[model samples]
Target: MVFLIQKSQNKDSKAIHLKLSEIIASHQGTSNRMVNIEDLTELELDQLRKFYVQLSKLAAKEDA
Candidate 1:
């Protein structure tokens, strides 16, 4: 299934979001932000998840 995450809120987040978008687009061959969960291998998904977690933590730090 395709997952469409919400847009991020600041410059750092926007950058991270753009990077992730690019990664998804590159992997999925589409311009849309939607990522196909089933298309990704386990390792790729784990790395993506880790990047997402890091981005969240970084955003939280910016808020503090």
Candidate 2:
């Protein structure tokens, strides 16, 4: 149903937002390269997917 689809998308967005926050937190004082959203290319994005998976696994483990 449309509601389910909307809920799924919302969940995904929240996951992405949480993962992004963690990623930023992890690099808070490091010299790690940070890019602006407008500067991201497709390849940079593909690489960033790894962080999301890692963050989600971490979150799942914490919940369990």
Candidate 3:
């Protein structure tokens, strides 16, 4: 999954995946974890989507 995501042309997706990788890598136990995408609030999800859209535009410009 990480390999596929890291290959993404969209910088936001790549960056988000990297951050997720770091969070998983730093985990110490099976029961305890800090990164929880499922627990994100609606506002946070909206913000994340906005960021992705912004980055996607930048990616398109770069491609052009």
Question: Candidate 3 — which residues are off by over 4 angstroms?
Answer: 1-35
Q: Who wins the lDDT comparison?
A: 2
For model 2, residues 31-58, the per-residue Cα lDDT tens digits are 2344343245545554666666687688
Q: Is candidate 1 or candidate 2 better by lDDT?
A: 2
C-alpha lDDT of residue 25 in model 1: 37
Model 3 agreement with the true structure over 1-64: per-residue lDDT tens digits: 8876654435445445544544444447332332454355545655655765676687689999
List the pairs of residues colliding in candidate 3.
Answer: none
For candidate 1, which ten residues in a row score worst on lDDT?
A: 1-10
Model 3 lDDT at residue 42: 45
- Record all residue pairs in model 1 with backbone atoms less than 3 Å apart, i.e. clashing: none
Candidate 1 ranges beyond 4 A from true positions: 1-33
CA error at residue 43 for candidate 1, angstroms: 0.2
- By lDDT, the better pick of 2 and 3 is 2
TM-score of structure candidate 3: 0.46
2 against 3, candidate with superior TM-score: 3
Q: Rate the local accuracy (lDDT) of all candidates.
A: 0.53, 0.58, 0.53
